[model samples]
Structure formats: C-alpha cells, structure tokens
Target: MQAEIGTPEAVGLSSERLERIVPWMRGYVEAGKLPGLSVTVARRGQVVFSRSAGLRDLARGLPMDDDTIVRIYSMTKPLTSVAILMLYEEGRFQLDDPITRFLPEFRNMRVLVGGSRAKPETVPAERDITFRDLLTHTSGLTYGFMDATLVDRMYREEGVDFQTAETSLADVVAKAAGLPLLAQPGAEWNYSIATDVLGHLVAVISGQPFDAFLRERIIRPLGMVDTDFHVPPEKIARFASNYALGEGGRLTLIDDAREGRYAKPRSVPSGGGGLVSTASDYARFCRFMLGGGALDGVRLLGRKTVALMTANHLRGDLADMGQPRFSESSYSGIGFGLGVSVMLDPAKAQILGTPGEVAWGGAASTAFWIDPAEDLFVILLTQLMPSSTWPIRRELRVLTYAALIE
Candidate 1:
C-alpha cells in the first residue's frame, strides 16, 4: 500500500517536520519492514503533529487512516493502574493493603525454591501481596512470554493467555494461583501476571466487572471512544492487521483480531494486557495523566494520587524489581510505578529525556510516555513487536525534545 502524505496545512502539522519524519517511517515500509504506522505528538493539550503512514492492511492494500485502531498490549497497564488508583482516591482501599484484603486466594502464597524445575518449597510468605506490589510489578508474577524457566514454561504449557488468547481474566488468575511465585511478595521485582491479577482484584473490590468500572471511571470521563477490549462490527475493518518480521526479511501478517470470545462482555478484562485503542484515543488518556489526574475539569484521580502513582516506588537493587527480557534496552535499571515504568536516572535508563518520565507499551508495539517535567506526552502506535528496537521512538523523542529548546 502506498503512503498517505498529508501536507502540513492539511493535517495541522509542520510540513518541514512532517516531511522529515515521514521519510524514516516510509523507509521501513518501502524496505518491506513495517506494514502500517501512526504517530501523534501533543504539546500542552493540543495536537501539533498527527500523521498516519504505511498500509493498515497489506493484503487489501488499505492505507492507515488517522482513526485506524491498533492493539495496545501492555499500554493498558497504566490505565488499569489509574482505575485502581481512582478507587484508592474514593477511599475504597489503600495501596499498601494486602491483596488478600480483596482476594483470599493470595493470602497465604508460597515462593518457588530449590531449582527452577523443582516443586516450590512451602515457605510461609513473609508478607501479603500489596496493591502497590501489583502496581510496580514487585509482586512475583511471571509473564509466560518473557522467560523460559520452569515456571514460565509451565505458564505457557497451561496456556497463560495474554492479548491474543481466548482465556478470561478469572481463568488467568486461577492458573496464576496454582503456579509458584518466583520470589516472595515485595521481595524482588519480577514482572508477572500481577497486573492481570490486579484486574480480578479490581472486579472484586469495585463490585463491578473490571471493564465496566474502567468505562464508568476512566474511559468515559476521558472521552476515549475507541478504546476497549473489543471492537464493534463497524470498526473491525479499519482495525490494522498484526504484522511481524518473517523469514528472509519479509513482513507477514498475523491475525490478532478479537474473536467472539472477546466481543461479548468479558468476565476478565485484563488490567495488564486486554485493551485495543487508537493513537488519538490513547492520547486523551496520556493527556489526562500528563495533566495530573484531570482533563478539562474531569478529574478521575486526586492530584496527590496521580503524583504517587508516577513516583518511583521501587527499593533495593532496581534490578531485583523485574527481569525484563530486554535488559540491555534503555529501560534496564528503571523502576516500576503502580502501572508504568518510572525513569530514576536518565543516564541509567539511557533514554534521551528527563528523570521521572513514566512510560509503558503494549505487545503490539504501541508506546507512549508522559514527561511531566517537559509537559510533553508522545504516543506512537504500530502493530508489530519488539517496540523498543525501532529507531522511530528514539528519533521521535530526540526530535520532539529538540523542538522544545528555549
């Protein structure tokens, strides 16, 4: 599919800047690398640059429209964390509350011991899993995809479904409960199914299904019309196909569309990885977070709560927090906040930005960062994998930051 080159005036973008970024984006498409891409940058609550490039569907040769929806994998975590924090603001619960306060199954959990393949030794949990641990990923939950250890292998063997699978959130939690934790709760950082478990807790605490609570609290108030776990019939065609690098440098389409399983009201709305959203819709969320728990008089969280959520809550060696597969990537040594990654040291993070810049991405290569110090929020969307490997993000950050030079 050919690229849609909107003039600077047509899209309210700076022509020179758009022209500059377009080549890098198009180069990948022209090189048979990426299939579809869309990026939007906002400054002080107004979109200064919004551009859609490449084909949304390579088979049909559909151009990526501005409104095309992309699957946002882990990016859902921040929003889910916010919803959880909103409950915190309502005096519904405390961050330090043991998760057992809501879910009893986790009350007396045990940690894995001996060898990776060995059965977990029954050591009494030193402490109960707290809501904060869930938020920061300090809770010893494991994502089946990121590792290949015994427990991780077991997670996959049992089909620990993330975004693409048909499993419900309750199914995920029940499976997680049976698995041995990699470490004691709050003892070390290991990114796991902790957020998905938090989703179930959200359901248990709010007395409403996770999806309903999120809609009633965050999505509705923020005007995120196109953000949800499933897409309706009308929006399905515009949904971009998931793409990945294939043999011999070819781009192959992988179908990730939601089946009927996700279409109906789901019992498990994954607080961790169950959201599909557009660049614009997600921008509203990023904007609200950048605006300090409020947007246009619609405040979803208290200013103090938003501040706490973004603050670095990790202690001890930051490396103990979670073992990211991409440890060498810029996010290494970074701290996890309630639902997002907190940049403790720009030098340590190796990203060209200020400290305290909170960020997260989805499995489908969707990413966004809220730089409160710079008053900047940058969101990039694409249906692919290994989001950090791309130069688009780093270059975009540099370009965006360079433009703000005083």
Candidate 2:
C-alpha cells in the first residue's frame, strides 16, 4: 500500500492494451476456475496496475478484495533462501561447505539407488550435501508428496512433512536427514524441501528462531507488515479462504480462515510453504527483489548477492537436470537459481519472457516474477490449490508483456 501508484502510460506501458487483462481475469472467475484472485504489476519501482476479482469466501458471499490475505505456500522458499543468504554475507558459512557442518544428523546420508517402498537400497552420498546444493535444489532430498520415487514414499512413511503444523521444523527436518535421498547431492535438480533446511540453518547460524530471524531481518525491514507465518486473530477477517480443485472442476473449500491452522499459532512454520500475505504485502517483496535487494532505503542484501541469487546456477535447464515428474514449471528453457527459477531460453521454454527473469509460484496458484532486465515485476494471488490445475501464470505473462511499449 505504501507503493506509489502510477499510470501505465507513465511507465512505458499502454493502458488500452492492459485492459486485455480485465476480461481474461473475469472469465476465469466467471468460469469457476478460481475462487478469487488478485494481480499487481509494477514497472520501474512504481505500481502501474492492480486488480482483484471473484470471491474470497464463496459460501459467505464475500468477494475477493485488494487486501485479501492468502497462503503463499512454496513462495515462502525465496524468503527462506534470502534468510540464509544474509548469513552467507556474514561469512557464517561457505556455499560449498557441507551442511553437516551445522546439522550433524545429515552426516553419512545415503542416496536411494534401488528399491521398493517396503524394501530399499541406498548408498552413502558421494559428497556431503552442501549449502550450494540446497540453494540450487541440486540436493538429493525429495518431498513426500512427489509420490514418484521410493525416497518420497520413505518421507511419507517416516513423516518428513513440512505441510502439517503438528510436527516442528526441527522434527521434520530431522526426519528428512535420516531418510534416503533420491539422488546424489549436486547431481540432479529436483524441487525439494531444501529451503526448509536453509531456514533451520538461518536459525542455527544466527542464534535466533527461524521465524524471528525472518521477521526481524527481512519482513519488518522490508515494511511487509502483513506477511507472517500465521494470520493473527485481528487479521483473520482479511484472510482469504483456500480451495482445492475437485472431481468435476468444482471448487472445494480446503481451509477456512476462521479455524484453519493459519488462524492460530502453529509449531512448524514451513519455510517452504507456510506464509500468509496480501497483494500489497507481497508486492513490496517483489519490489524489494526488483530493487536489487533493498527498498525504501533499507538494504537487506548487497547488489552482488542479489545478482548471484537471480542468475541461473544449473548445468542447463530443469529438463537437463532430470527434474522429478512433478514441477509446475516446464522443464525446458528454465533453470534454478539460488532461490527462484531463472529464465534460460524463453524460446525453448515457449513462454513470453526475457532471459534472466526470476519467478516462482505457490501451491495455491499464487505466483510472482521479477524482470531485472525490464525493471518490472508482476504478482498474482489466488486461492486455488494444486497450481498446475490451471495455466494462469503463462497467460498473464503474455498479457503483461504485450502492454509494454518501451
């Protein structure tokens, strides 16, 4: 909300062309593709456009508003990634340093070579899982929900979950450490729970609780007041309900704002996918990143660190990295950076974008992208789960980019 609003024409964008977004968004809501949604765009550090549509709570007849607080889910990964990098700037640890240097539990971790969920084979990891591997998602770790590999099933059986709040982050990460990895560390790029481990690292290295470190070092400093691990009682009214796509393309309420876990305090704040934020709050985040790690005269990271974080760090695109069968991103033309996905070849990715732009989305179809090259960024917030259920992000890129006139 602190962002100064500007006319699209003032920022080298065509207002008339931007209108193309209105009906496109309304059609999604009218067609029941989303419960509700919010979209915000900025060029050169000024808000050029923002819009919201549909219902935040269908049964309550509540409409989605500009201030609706929604679950950002995996979008939390980038914040966690930044948290650890702050420590990296402090010389707390080197990127290549073994994570076992802090959490000894990961020592002698094994990689799943051959197996069934009931009976498995594993080998000692060739090298220790490094901080770099964690940042780039080259870590051998896997998410239980992947359900594609034996190691993923192991995560389920062993209870290595970040989604549920009953288990603390310490407990869940410890569970992951004991389980077999899906690949050798740094050998493959699989979207995994590495950022959750990075959050724990931030705590251990800074001698502060993970959430506290983020709140003090990142959230508060960035002026993102509404961004937090849980929605407070006073803010619950503004929280948007979360929905899952059902059997017949119908929307089903999965979590209600009044009594959902987000409504109260929880033990494990999933650094991977637990934050609740509003359009304005997250726009500040995107602005901070687009501003090269600082905003409102507060610098959280140096210019070089931001550059390193946004640059592609993979051997090739995710396709070359043998990504697991389940990522919302296309395997080609996109590469993993420290915390976000970097555009490698837009032509190959077949999406409308400039190379080197960075982006990531949540499980709820919430997504954001920062184009350093263009000095522009866009954010979409909605309450539809299993983000893959729709192709909203791709279409938004074309609509947003087509409006650019300079």
Candidate 3:
C-alpha cells in the first residue's frame, strides 16, 4: 500500500519550518560537502515531508530524485538482524545458542592475548560466541578499516573487507573463524562482520541463498521493491554516484553509477554493508518496524519479538567497552539492541531524540531513526562516503525534532 502523503501540519509539524530542511541541506551541496541528499519524514503512518537537493551524478549533472538508489552500507545490519530474529521465532535457534552449533568452524575459538601482526599470542575464548553476541556486536570481531590493532591487520591481510566481490560469504566467515578474535566473546562491543556471519546462518537455517532469503522473506514482504544487493540493468540510471572528499576538500567520485561493482551480481552478499535502497523503500521498512514488524497485512515478526529486538541488551555503559575512537555516535547513554542503537538517555547523548529510539546509519552518510514515543520515523539518504566525515546525522536529528510542533 502507498503511504498517505499529508501536509506537515496534519502530523503536528510546522509546514513552514519543515521547508527549512531544503535550504539547510542545499547548503551542504552548495559547499561541495555532499553531492546530493534525499530526506523523508513520516508520522502516524503518513509521510509528512519529503525533499531532495543537488545532483546524483556531478559530471552528468543528473539531479537526485525521490527514487534514486544509493548504497546503504552498514544500515544492512538491521535487516539482517531482523532475518535472524525471524528464524528465531520459528524455533530455529535461541538467542543465547552457541553459533558453533551450526558452524563447527567456530568451535574452540581463541582470543588474541598479545603479539605483533605477524605472530599473535592467543588464549582460549571464555565461552562460545552466541547469537546474542553477534546481534549486539559483543562477539569480539573487529573490522579492519576501523582499527589498527594486530587483529585488525590480520583481518586486512586475510581479505576480510566486506566490499570485496570475489569471495563468498561462507568463505569470508570461514577465514574470520580461523583468526583470533579481538576480545573474548561477550566481553565487549566491537563493530565487525558478525552480521555477515548471521547472514550465513540465515542461509544455513533457511536452506536458501543469503540474497534469495533476504529478497523472498524480507525485501519483498514489506514492498521494498528497489532494495537489493545490486541494482538491476533497468534501474542503473537511477543509481546515484558515490563520493568522497579528496585532497584539498574537493568531491571525488568513488563509485560510478553506470559501471560500479553493484551494477552486477556480487559473489558475497555483504550483510554488514552491501545493500542499495531509496528513501521511499527504506521509509516503508521503518514503517514496518514502527508498525511492530508488520506492513499492511504482512507480518515478518511478532509484536513481542519487535519489542525485544529494540530493547537495550547491554549490561553496562557502552563506554565500558572502550568505544572505538572512529565511531560516529557517542557511547554514553547509548546501547546496542539486536541490530540498532537504543537511546537510553537523549540528554547524555546531547541529541534531540526520545529515549528508546532505535536508529542506525550507513557508511555513506545515510541514516534512519524510529521513534516509538512520537510515532515518527525519518530517513535520510545520500552518497557521501565515510559518514563520520560530517555531523549531518546530529544536525538532522535536531532539525527533525525541532519541526515537531505538536
């Protein structure tokens, strides 16, 4: 079903104030800080504000539109997490179940104790890596690009990067399994390829290819027709060019829309950071989550399951884990849920957001947040790489909440 488009006033927001987002966003484009951006806000299951600015392709002068598809990167985690919970609801596996139950490669996993990149001292893991550890990123895995530790360097040397198109997901997980973990299981939260491991488990449990299971069970059910691991031939023109700030602060083309890696099928469907989607398509997904895991008549998860997924699963302050220096958001007053971040205290976060808000973002400055308190959801899509390069997410949060006059 199509979302009912309504005036901002109908959803308890100031229409005049909502228009301010356009100029605010256009300023980033004008300053060459971003190539293009598209934003959508929905309240009470109705779209209140939608806008786009600048160009999707700088060279071709292609304008960004409502339907422009852009890489979502790490935002893919939430969807993969939901897929795992879906199988959990089907009695496939318990949240605390050892992952080695299915993948024996993970059995007797070891943790890095001390050593150089060439040779590392290791000790046996305190316990087996569990499904909860994977969902909350406490499984001790670490991404290579985000850190400079010996384990991270090991990840780099092993070709553990998610952007690769050559290796399969199974192979990637197998390689990671052979490496010593960055920490003991459930000891700390470290952003890693745990979601890709979950993706492999999804394939194993569902008896379907990872991409096929996502398309069949999640993407199609919620009517996210344009979301996929790759853009089809017909939709290539609508795919946006990815950009990164280069030397001297000029926009550099990182990924071309017409002939990029995503233009063709990829061998490894990166559940950690490899999905492309549009503003509308993702809004529908947010609406599904906001609707308690159902959209229209399709129900992907139970209401209780949705509640559990969004709740904070952390035992102590996220800061206790020695939060990664390169992380985009502050760890104080924030906790990891199944796949998203749960706001334990908006004031501590220094952001204008509600407590219990579930949110996540991608590497390309794309972000989304679901506020059950206000019955609201917002999606921001863009093509700028390294989302940490700017404070757009925080600015957008303030911009969105300030417009809620009601």
lDDT winner: 3
Tens-digit lDDT string for candidate 3 (1-406): 9689998898898888888898999999999999999889999889989899999999889999999999999889999999989999999889999999999999998999897776789999989999999999999998888766888888898888778848788898999999999889988888888999999999998889999999999999999999999999999999999999999999999999997899999999998888999999999899899989999999999999999999999885477676554454578888888989898988788789998899999999999999999999999999898898889999888888999998
Q: Give all candidate RMSDs, comma-separated.
A: 4.2, 1.0, 1.0
Q: Which ten residues in a row have the lowest lDDT in candidate 2?
A: 322-331
- Report residue 203 deviation for candidate 2 (angstroms): 1.0
**Model 1 Cα lDDT, one tens digit per residue, 151-254:** 67778877776554566777778777777777788877666677888777778888888888888888888898888887787778777787777788687766
Q: What TM-score should be assigned to candidate 3?
A: 0.98
In model 3, the Cα lDDT at residue 279 comes to 91
Per-residue lDDT, model 1, residue 339, is 82
**TM-scores of all models?**
0.90, 0.98, 0.98
Comparison by lDDT, 2 against 3, better one: 3
User: What lDDT does each candidate get?
Assistant: 0.73, 0.89, 0.90
Task: For candidate 3, give the lDDT of residue 197.
Answer: 92
Tell me the lDDT of model 1 at 74.
Answer: 80
Question: Model 2 scores what on Cα lDDT?
Answer: 0.89
lDDT of 2 by residue, 1-406 (tens): 3788999999899999988988999999999999888899999878988998899998888889989899999899999999999999989999999999999999999898896766888889999999999999889988889888888788888888887848678888998998988899999988889989998888888999899999999999998889999999898888888898788989998999887889887798788888999889888888888878888899999989999999999888899987556675788999988999999999999988999999999999999998989989999999888899889999999999999999
Q: Model 3 lDDT vs. the true structure?
A: 0.90
